[model samples]
Target: MSQMVRRLNDEIESTANMCVRNGKVELLKKVAREFRVEQKSFLEHLEELEDHIYLCFLTINRSRRLVVRLGHTRSPKHQFTLQELNMFYPTSKRIEDPGGT
Candidate 1:
């Protein structure tokens, strides 16, 4: 079970790498369309991680990789803060309420 979960994690990481190389938003949408089940499973695995240090390490590493792949962007509009994200972006579960409360 651990092995299978690791493999699935690797697959999701690969997809994420590709997403960073391409347009992250577009590639993520494509993945959601094509690999919805795997995407959900990967998220579930992340949620299951019990160790804060390990989870933070993994999250930071993945975020760094994505940032590096993004290269240096000249446009400031592409960048968003956590506050803006929290204020504006809606989760998949509540996408219907995109207007944000």
Candidate 2:
């Protein structure tokens, strides 16, 4: 599963690059369509990395960076470093009985 995600990540990065270089902006949807599965699975990694970054940075710089990209900017190449890396898994869990049923 991880291998698949890595492959997809590569594909996504390459495709995004192509979009910026050749200005093939329309190809994004197709590229994203093919990379959905990996994106969905990569949420945990994204969250963990974000937590680590937050822990590492203890200044106004981090907040400023986030604020700059705080908008519906779909153009991934422009956002670069702080693109809102979305992971499509449910992070919240429900409370239930701890039974071996």
Per-candidate Cα lDDT values, in order, are 0.64, 0.60
Tens digits of per-residue lDDT, candidate 2, 1-101, equal: 45756997798788799897897877877766865867666677877776776766744566556556554454545553312422211235333334633
Candidate 2: misplaced stretches above 4 Å? Answer: 29-101
lDDT per residue (tens digit) for residues 1-101 in model 1: 46767997899889888888886877687777877768688667666774665767877787676566554542555775444334333464323334564
Write down the TM-score for model 1. 0.29
The alpha-carbon lDDT assigned to residue 76 of candidate 2 equals 43
Q: Pairs clashing in candidate 2?
A: none
Q: Tell me the TM-score of each prediction against the true structure.
A: 0.29, 0.28
Off by over 4 Å in 1: 29-101
Q: Candidate 2 at residue 41, lDDT?
A: 61
Report the number of the highest-lDDT candidate: 1
In model 2, the Cα lDDT at residue 21 comes to 88
